[model samples]
Target chain A: MAINKIVASVEEAVADVHDGAVILVGGFGNIWNAPSYLLTAISKLPVKNLTVVSNSGGFGIEIWGGVFGVHEHDVEVLHRTKQCTKHIVSAPTNPLVVNTLETRYRAGEVEVEMCAQGTLAERVRAGRAGLGGILTPTGVGIPEIQRDKPVIEIDDRKYLVEKAIKGDFALIRAHKADRWGNLVYKGTSRTFNATMAGAARVTIAEVDEIVELGELDPEAIVTPGIYVNRVVLRQ
Target chain B: MTEKFRIDDQTMALRVAKEFKDGDVVNLGIGVPTLASNFIPGDREVIFHAENGVLGYGNICTAGEGSYDLLNAGGQPVEPRPGMSILDHAESFCVIRGGWLDWTVLGGLQVSEKGDLANWMVPEKKIGTIGGAMDLAFGAKKVIVVMPHNTKNGGYKIVKECTYPITGFRCVDLVVTDIAVIEVTPEGMVLKEVAPTWTPEEVQQLTEPRLIIAPDLHEIELA
Candidate 1:
């Protein structure tokens, strides 16, 4: 039988994701690009001890909740519901924000691992490309960041060797996708979603529109279907 | 409370914006650096690159006028200019890591005589995040910093060596502060220009490292 990559529901798309799973959520602190439906669904599940890797913890949190009515659920919902036990993110929150993941971090409720934005994306890319790691000049001298990592010196400059980060599942938002899962993204929303596409064992995309396989222009597709396991329409 | 000695944020931004060459692709870090984008002379066609993904984005829009999909790295809504193009995060950093960016203006908490930068973390405060500052600091052809001359409590930020964690070593080329425009040279900090009310000697008193006045030192132009 021919395989169908389309899932009937977002819940079913993320059904296999359970406790202690390393899941990648894609977005760059913008509500439009974030996988809100997937994130919202994840919040409802009984999953715990999830290590989430993303660019920012969520968008609009600094706005003291969303100024715009676009986002259904920010990543903070997952933290609030106790679905995520740890977060490996770059821009977590502004220090001034009243209620943030930093509060939980201070309480030792959730574990937080900070990664540089470029390093985070590159590490995830490395995971998909089957590379050992990346040697970057970022975070080389920082005691907290470089203390435990291996350092490689090239051309008289020292670089930290960051290992690739692979997720058990990836939840990404895309602008358009075909039945075969070839995806296209819109504007700033494309930040981390396209990079996180294949960096996981099962890459599930939540898209605004799903077209026929041949409908999407080849040049416009950011992620090929080969990297994607399932596609669900955004609510 | 009139403080004639200090330049306002816009003046500081304009001073740094004047350094941009025509056709230069500049990445402006948040705060003072972000303000530089507003002061870029209309005659110069500088492309603004936001690490969030877009290149050639225009000014930050007013609250109701913005399209949520279009935003800068700081998460503020912006309008993309004619030549603007948006790419993914990896490709955006590729522009930085590949040494394609012409210049990047960042804010610094502390800058050493050797140009070592420490802008991301202040351990005393538990909350901090290192975004693309490191990549931009090392990747750009020229790394310039726009910051205050001293801390809020009147402590020097330009130091002999940074007490905070280092972001990039010997990376900063220029320093634009409220009181002075200083250049980081191999020998030491060169005082290029000072605020009109403040003399180079006065600015030197606030700086931790010894300031060497340039031969053609002049006051910052406010016009």
Candidate 2:
């Protein structure tokens, strides 16, 4: 694993991604988000039908680029969209995540999976912790959501299966990163970045500014060096 | 000084809304509480906070003025004010935790005699999570509840004890309902004023529990 964290641009960072691979993108409604430059890159490239791992299905599709179609077309929108959906899987209850579903799901083009935000946090935690699958009592019933249908019996108590989320490519936004590839965020930016890095096979970050490796505080650095494959500077 | 202080659900919602004051940071919980923002005097600044992480929420967005990407916690297209700020989810919680909120107007299933609030969760249903209702109930300096006086079948909502899960400790300060305005104190839901055409005895009779009467109740100032 040649962990050369610094790359020239987001395009070079995500150039390896081919069409049809699932990519986990970081950001909430385009704020403190993974570098969109890659999306800009893929927009022109041959890649299509991208499976994006994100809080919502939002991108230029909802605004700016008229690609709000992606918000409708995401096969697995991690949050609820306006597409009018039901909880098929355990989903995040966080309002922001739910709003995404309310908007895109009602459009009837996307499928929304409802998972707990804490569960998403924990699952990503498991990926970082190097575990196969972690179990919990998050989503049990309402009977409509049918993931892990087998009612696994644990001491007469029933539990549902929550599968781990692993992505082929991890995209993240960092406030600062060094040329050697250490990253930092201005505030509570660590919410999804660390877990996203762990869950993805090739993690790519688009940082506001790139610096040297030792330029960052060893303690302040959230995602460690092992998980990050490459870092690219954002415009 | 005998002017009747009666306001139905809508007026109660709009009139008590005067307390928001200009430029005051306010968080409107779901439902009727959400309507209070509409009543807020718009000429001056009254910033609204929706826990889903949008600050400086604006009123009725015109067509084409709304951003598909910009949304309220409820996921509706809302006009971002001139001074709007977007925040991350966890950081939004921090603003609530840091006591940055001025007032939180919440809608409740019930307001107990002790001012306890039961707004966020419904036991056994398992539908929605208690997003920052608990935080706002206790975090905001002032907690105001706006609700209907009676249920559909004419049952009262102001009760002796909450028969539901609670979002915060005994923390509700003022309640503006269709029938009356009540203040939640340690002494229980003391009747602060009577709605027009309704007597204290009539209001008490309609209530499930005997709400306490303040020694000196008066009419709403009607802001």
How accurate is chain B of model 1, given as a TM-score from 0 to 1?
0.95
How does residue A193 of candidate 2 score in lDDT?
A: 58
Query: Candidate 2: deviation at residue B214, Å?
Result: 3.9
Candidate 2 CAPRI-style tier: incorrect
**Candidate 2's iRMSD:** 7.5
Model 2's number of clashes is: 35
Which docking class does model 1 fall in? medium
Q: What would the per-residue lDDT of candidate 2 be over residues B43-123, giving only the tens digit for each residue? A: 878888876566887874655577644555444557667887655444465566567888888888788877877764445
Chain A structural similarity (TM-score) per candidate? Answer: 0.94, 0.73
A63-156: candidate 2 lDDT, tens digit per residue? 3324233232222223322212233222223333334543454445445454444344445556656776555443444233325555566987
